[model samples]
Target: MSLPRIAVDAMGGDEGVRVMVEGAALARRRHDRFKFLLVGDEMLIKAALENHPNLRAASEILHAPETISGEEKPSQALRRAKHTSMGMAVNAVKAGHAGAAVSGGNTGALMAISKLALRTMPGIDRPALAALLPTLGDNDVIMLDLGANTECDARNLVQFAIMGAAYSRIVTDLDSPRVRLLNIGTEENKGTESLRDAANQLKLAAQGLELTFDGFTEADKICRGDVDVVVSDGFSGNIALKAVEGTARFVGDLLKRAFTSSLRSKLGFLVSRPATELLRGHLDPNNHNGAVFLGLNGIVVKSHGSASALGVANAVHVTARLLEENLIERISGDLAKLGGHGLGNGRAAKGAAAKDAAE
Candidate 1:
């Protein structure tokens, strides 16, 4: 296999260069074709790599000499920390030095710097960061804009759905994925004027992209697997995502304590080894390591702020798959049919409700 290059923002996470080095090493250990360009302070990176000499052979260090703090405001930090590792790493991909970039830095700063450095593809007014939300069934549900676009209009939402659907098609290979608007209720005309307007535009985007949209879906329906793509403004999507994560972790702890009590239950757990393994693997947060900021020029993965070495490693692996698949090109090509013209209002074919009432 041909080698693909990835740039790591060595100063992004709290662990700093140490975790980044370990994550890059983990990727190299798994795939010989994976080469990394570690961008960070020259001295700190060198010292960290001395402790893990194995990384030196497969990864090369790019001296950034500055770091972007997690607390710094996005747009401001990008200007102040012009020489930060995150900025340099983004430049690496923009300059063709890497195929993808991964950072656990301030998400806003990363987004701003990346957009300024690489710019958006033509016809894309705004880029969105897509996230994977854990669902009950086999595969994860795709949610976005993940705080990328806060005040999205109907047109922006339509474009976001198009990008998201392309991602699901390539990543999960779902045939005719169900796209739904995240709303207060499943009933038609249930949300704000913005949501109703967005839903109508979604129908237009769907028609242009040849995607299947199932209309408005309540938050409770996320796990039913009836919808593969859930579209919402970033503010609401992030809240629902965090709430679900907290709930899942709380339930997991409860299950662990329940199984450890008494000899009888312990024996039953031993008998149910396969079942337990299935649940643990499916529910394990580490498996879902990185969230890709889609529609950017190159793949940029934002890992969890508290991610461990294992989580970082999984992120590198995901970056590799995304690059190999050429996800951006696929998305742009598929959605080209979706012109930026105004999408007609999407009411339920008008007055069909009155006809049915008369019947």
Candidate 2:
């Protein structure tokens, strides 16, 4: 099969065009069939490509004079969608010129523009931010609604579960992934009505699902290697994700202080350098830089705004993999089993009926 070409926003990321271009080169080396449509200022992009001869051979450039700044509001960014590099890259996918679009630009802007240009997939009310997180198991776990919808109903949560499970299957190479809902406790009745309703519905739909619905899982146990996908509302999922990242940085900093506190501690650190290096590799966010906007008509992978060259490459790798696996098709198949009802429609209608009976 012919490889798909990716549209990249060359002016995105904290490190600018150099990192994006170099990353493309690295990805090209690894996946020789991968092609690039680098969109940004042609002169600068060309200069950066001079250092990467291989990438220059496999890539083409599209000039986009403007760039969306990280601090710009989504509304403000949308107005410039026609002229910005991020916007053009996303438009490339909508135009069918590229299979996917990758960017390390403003998260809110990227989400806003992508939805406007590509729209949501059929039967999907909204798209969720699905990201790969490190787990103690051999494979990574997929988490969703990281910051998309702060408030979700029972049906919305159920949709996230389905989307997340589909993503897990592709990334982890698993036949049947084990999914769990993130909650304060694992008991059946511990959460709100929405959580309870979603859980019941998942159980009802489990017979038709290709994945195993493992009920509820606590936040502390998400990385225990037992769960393959963790679903939650954007409010809670975002908090949990941030807390985990902060804790990792905290521990690393504390260890650095202890190791340098004295000669004895420094000697001990030297003795355990190999083990620490392995741990660092596992915890490095760069190894897992891509966060996909699932449920969109076209694939859009969001890279960390502060990503390095290798980090951007990893994001590109994720985009290619999703396209190869036909992620959107897989999600559509699972959604079809839920009937033609839109997200949350069943539960909403039921609630209205109950109110009528009470009145």
Candidate 3:
């Protein structure tokens, strides 16, 4: 098979064309099988490419006259998408010119354009924003619906579980990842009606599904590295993710302060430098920089706006892995096994109504 080509929004990130081009070159060095479609102002992309001879050799530039600003609303961005760098990059995926698209542009704009251009897959009503988070386990955990749909029904939650599990299989190399619904407590009746409903449905289909639906998981237990995938509506998922990010930063900062408190502390820090460096490498967001828009027909990865070249390369690496694994096909197959009674097919609602009537 031919190497997959990734479409890049060279002007999207805070670091602009230079960082994007350098990142692509770094990614190419890691995976020689990858090719890139650099979409942005030709003049700028060319100038950046001059610094990366290998990237220039492996890339094809497509000039986009305009670029989307971070402050632009999704509505306004959609209207001007055709003329924007982010838009052109996404269009490349829709046009089948690129297997995947990666951008560090405005999150809302990227989501809007991806949905409009590639559309959602057959079984998913909405695409979920998923990211790989560091865990204590042998592999990182895959969490979904990070910020796509703020409010989701039971069916939507179920869909997220399926999508998250499929992603885990590819990225973590787990045959049957342990999937869980995020809840306030582990009790079966602890969460909202939607959470309970989704859990019941997952249990009913667990034996046939590709993943192991391990019931409810709490936010605190998420980083313990036991669970493989965590599924939640965007509202809770986003809050939980932010809390985790904040806590990580706080701890890191505290450690730095403690180490610099005095000469003795600084000596201790020097002695433990190797261990601290290892910990830092594991916790670095740049190592896992891709937040994928799952359930879309085509692959789209949202890189952090402030990400470094290494982060950009990691995001591109994620796109390559998704393309190589055929993640969408796996997700579609899993959804298919649920049959007509699956989530988003009125089955969950009908069952819920019957239960309510009985009560």
Best by lDDT: 3
Tens-digit lDDT string for candidate 1 (1-359): 57568999988887777887788788767766778899998888888888677778778889986788888898787786558889989989998999889998888888888888878876566788887766777777888887887766555666678778877776677866788888899777797666776676666567656469889888888877767888887887877777878888899888878888889888988999899899887767767778888777788888776777887888887788787778888777765665433332223312322332344
Per-structure clash totals for the candidates = 0, 0, 0
- Residue lDDT tens for model 3, 1-359: 89668999999999998999999999889778878999999999999998899989889999999999999999999999999999999999999999899999999999999999999999787899999999988999999899999888777888888899999999988889999999999999899888899899889877787799999999999989889999999999999999999999999999999999999999999999999999999999999899999999999999999999999999988888898889888999888887644544656656764654455
Give the per-residue lDDT of model 2 (tens digit) for 247-277: 9899999999999999999999999999999
Candidate 1 vs 2: which has more TM-score: 2
The parts of candidate 2 lying over 4 Å away from their true place are 340-359
Better of 1 and 3 by lDDT: 3
Q: What TM-score fits each model? A: 0.85, 0.94, 0.95
Is 1 or 2 the stronger prediction by lDDT?
Answer: 2
- Residue 156's lDDT in candidate 2: 73
Error of 3 at 142 (Å): 0.6
Check candidate 1 and list the clashing pairs: none
Superior candidate under TM-score, 2 versus 3? 3
> What's the C-alpha lDDT at position 158 in model 1?
68
